[model samples]
Target chain A: MSDSVVLSLAEADSLAREVLEAWGLAPDHAAAVAATMVAGERDGCTSHGLYRLLVATASVEKGVVNPAAVPEVSEPAPALVRVDGKGGFAQLPFSKGLPLLVEKAKAKGIAAMALNNSVHFAALWPEVEALAAEGLVALAFTPNHAWVAPAGGTKPVFGTNPLAFAWPRPGREPFVFDFATTVIARGDIELHRRAGKPVPEDWGYDAQGNPTTDAKSVLDGAMRTFGGHKGSALAAMIELIAGPLIGDMTSAQSIAVDAGRGGSPLGGELIIAIDPAGFLGDRVDEYLAHGETMFAAIEGQGARLPGTRRLAARRESLAKGLAIPAAFHAEILDLLQKGKDHVPNPPQGSRAGSNGAGDGSGGH
Target chain B: MSDSVVLSLAEADSLAREVLEAWGLAPDHAAAVAATMVAGERDGCTSHGLYRLLVATASVEKGVVNPAAVPEVSEPAPALVRVDGKGGFAQLPFSKGLPLLVEKAKAKGIAAMALNNSVHFAALWPEVEALAAEGLVALAFTPNHAWVAPAGGTKPVFGTNPLAFAWPRPGREPFVFDFATTVIARGDIELHRRAGKPVPEDWGYDAQGNPTTDAKSVLDGAMRTFGGHKGSALAAMIELIAGPLIGDMTSAQSIAVDAGRGGSPLGGELIIAIDPAGFLGDRVDEYLAHGETMFAAIEGQGARLPGTRRLAARRESLAKGLAIPAAFHAEILDLLQKGKDHVPNPPQGSRAGSNGAGDGSGGH
Candidate 1:
């Protein structure tokens, strides 16, 4: 974390969008990506924010992402649709596809849209959270680069595949529960590596299934499931439901194929949006009554609703303007400088084997 | 687990429904409850089957459930409806509510239904699996009775709330994933108590936050979360999304509330069903293509998907008939014999407590 001059939210987003455009993403696509990344930053999720820009840009330059590719929507029913990413940037699928599903859900009680052949998008909460803000409930699952192991084993058989869900509540923050079903997310591991720190031993295991605190050991080996077999079961179940059920790539097939980056083949995603009013009607009037009574009973006890922490965080962010490291601000400036220097040249050959662009800076 | 008799599926359903009727449930409601419970037996979920008859019957007889209650459906959209269970049996909500949701989903592509004020309805997988067999994908979640602790600290704070999702797979078994978000379910603890055995130390914590191998400790205290804080967070998240978000009660306010027994309130459930053909269309053709390739790769490495084991158990039950222990069989007969006894003219307040319940001889 650099301690330098702070960047306003607008300045940070401007730089990110410029860098994305330099990577050959269209204006609209670049803006969408920039918005999500900035939202993550503003919400204190620095790991998923601007820090991821360089690698995403590199993927685009390598022809792995089609700047102008259109998402092909295959609508099978009024409530169901499939968006073939068409080798396009992932931002398009999440931004364009999610709203479509939300629209259908608003009209028809519920809607589910699946995206196949897509790249890794940003965190899922923002998309679902936005829907919740619109008074709709949304749940989305994304299976990405593999890292999680199965229960009772140290095999890297699943991804940190995060599951996210959001529900709009009257007179309160929308309840959004977003988490990776792994002991730790890949970004957390990278953060440890960057800081030259060892992880807790139980967070991961080495080749012989021995727990290790060494960051290098976890990087070289496999990450444990969040709750042993339960988490692994969830990851596998998510893959079966989100991928196979939705006609996306399976984890095994995703691993077998090379996805240009030498990273785990990016798989697919499933998003379900629900219009609460469509189902609850006047019953929506009862939520505040029910929730208040329940929360009142446990007030000041060791119980808080799921979104309370996030809500508290958001409150603090709005009051104090999202506490960010000065070092990260400097890194953002450096990326802006690099984008200005590199122009729009397409990346040559496979830079995939390397752990992203070796700038030691983060932003996507 | 009645070993003295091997009732065919039809016979078992008939007898079970007959027993429910004797407890004052309407004929249709009794049949629905019996059908769900018998299906659990058929699917080898012995823990949730006929062994639970006494608890269900007690709830009805104690006036905790309304025998003549009818679920009310309120539709807010073409694809969504809310089913108010009216403090009735869980089967009432499913029997009358699910078909409506399914019908709308078939026409509109998706349906979201929230079932509120219903008692425990046994394991959720059977419900979703049945829907999957009808060529739909279903996701079901219900906040349950608190019996397990959150990840870190000791003391029970969350239920062994199960999340179950089933997807329709062409030319293969409908992949189903159902699991309780606890280290060990309460049923397993009762099993240990009945067998005069102990649980693994790691499975639970005493009231002082120390690990214990004694099953009684967990029953008197709390079972630890499976993977520390992350598991607790997951359970907490589930309670918020599956409970409060659906206009139901959270665990904090639901402690000591037994949905199966009388005088205790039930929690809420949210079920989302989707018509895959509406979403996948021609891509449904690729479901197996992609999933098989992935499963084949994992198979090459000896990895199996979650729920594959349950499928195997189901097949065996079909082939060999449902298995039941001789002792358990006798216990059921004994209960039936008690129902037949001429002690029907007991005092108004006459009811058996833990001590009068046959020493819990059939717990396991």
Candidate 2:
């Protein structure tokens, strides 16, 4: 632990936007990417924030991410929309297509958006939360390069596949959560390794298929699904639903096709939106009240609701500023300078211990 | 352990149906209930099989379950159907409405069935499996009486809500799984208590808000969700979606309203069906092939698919016989005799160690 640099939220967002702009991304695209990263940072999700920019920039330089790519959306069914990300960032497709998805759901009671050929690097909660804010129940699932082993398996056969869900509470803040099927996300393991901490025995295994507590060994081997078979089953479901169901790469396929681009895997995401009011009519209010009662009961019983802590952190960051490691801040400044010079090369060793590919921040 | 009696599946089904018929249930209604129970036994889910019959029959006798009730289906939206169960077994409504649901999904790419005022006692997998067998991707959720504590909470505030998912794999058994949000179902804990065995540390807590391994304390206090907060959040989502969203009772509400009827709680279920072929067109077979590849990889890695064991048990039971406790078999026979005598009273001490209001087998 060392002294950190405190940058106001606006300053962080502007700086991130400028860096992406310098890399030749369209202003709007840069803004979307910056907003996602800044939100992650504001919520204390450091792995999905500024920590990922260098790798993302490097990925752009390597042509793994098309800077000028535009998503193409099509309605295959009245309640189903498909967006081909065209090798661009996932945020672009989601941002451009979610409105239509929400509209369809509002009109049809339920709708689905399948996003394919996208590179997902940010946390998944933002997209789901966005949908929830529109007064809809939202669920999102995405697969990544295989890094987790299925239950009782020795090798990695699935991604730290992430699932996100959000429920709107009308006037109150929405309840949102995003979690990886793995017992612990890769970023958490990276942090533990950096801190020389031992992970739980069930978190992962060694190369030889034996359970290991060492974070470093687990990283080199494979992460284990949380809750054993239950979590693994969920991971598999995501792989099927978000991958092949959406005409994108499965985790195994992603691993086979992805080059060492030092960025997130190019894959797909499946998002579902359900309009509660459309289905429940006036009864929606009663549903919200029930949720409130449950929340109050949980709090009274000394438990915190999901997303409460993250929302608190976000509020605090908005009021004050984001805390960034001093060294990381210096590195960002260096990257800024390089960006000014039109140098697209990501600094070597900038992301030590990161699997040449991105850490799959969507799972974080 | 005592030796068990094995009865052919047909014999079990006929016996269950006869008992229900003698209790004044219509032949068709009795047949539906018997089929569900027999399927549970055939799949090795004894908790939901003959073990639940006494409570179910008692419910009919107490008027908690309307044996002659028929569900009314109304289409509120093109892709959404609301089914009023009219206070009866869930299977009846599902049996009547699933074809319509499947038809709607095929026409619109996705459809949802909101079933309210239903008593769901059988395992949820069967419903989702039926939909999957029709070449659809299906998800089912239901809430029960409050028995599980939210993460970090000291008291039970949510049900051991169960979620089931199924994916069709053409020409093969569908991939289907149903799991309770709690670490283990209440029946399992009751079994542990009866056997004088301790549960895992993470399984539950004592009334004093301290973690306890004693199954009896867990039974009296609260059952913790599996995977801590993640599972708890899922339970909460189910409560919102399946309860209030369907114009039914939330778990806490159900607990407050339900009398000691020695039966499964009267609640609601949410079923969603998606037509992959409708959305993906000719690409579905390719998707199925990808799933097979992933399954092969998982098997090669020494991992078993989630539903393999259940499917195997079902096949075996259909071929051989259903293994059941001799005492339970004799009890069912005795109940049949009582039914023949027009005795509406549930046998005294029929349920061992149940908390007077049944074990909420919705989670089983």
Residues A1-364, model 2: lDDT tens digits: 3579889988999999988888866677788898899988998877888877787777677656766566778887888888777667788879989889999998989889888777778779999999998989999999998889999897988999999999888687798989998888898898899999999998898888899999999987889998888899989999988887766678877766564544577788999888887667766786677777888889997899988888898899888799888989999988777777874543221221222112222221
Q: DockQ of each model against the real complex?
A: 0.35, 0.47
For model 2 chain A, where is the 10-residue window of minimal lDDT?
A349-358
Give residue A185's error in model 2 in angstroms: 1.3
- TM-score for the second chain in candidate 2? 0.90
In Å, residue A291's CA in model 2 sits off its true spot by 0.9
Candidate with the greatest TM-score versus the true structure: 2
lDDT of each prediction vs. the true structure?
A: 0.66, 0.80
* Lowest lDDT block of 10, candidate 2 chain B: B349-358
Residue lDDT tens for model 2, B1-364: 2667888988899999999888866687788888988888888787788776787777777666767666778777778887776667778878888888999898888889887777777789989999998999999999988888999896988988999999998788899989999998888999899999999988888887789999999987899899888888889889988886666777877666555544677778899888887556777787677888888989997789988888898899988898787888889999888888875543222222222112223222
TM-score of each: 0.84, 0.91
Error of 1 at A67 (Å): 3.3
lDDT tens string, model 1, B248-279? 66654444444333343365677878776565
Q: Alpha carbon lDDT of residue A238, candidate 1?
A: 72
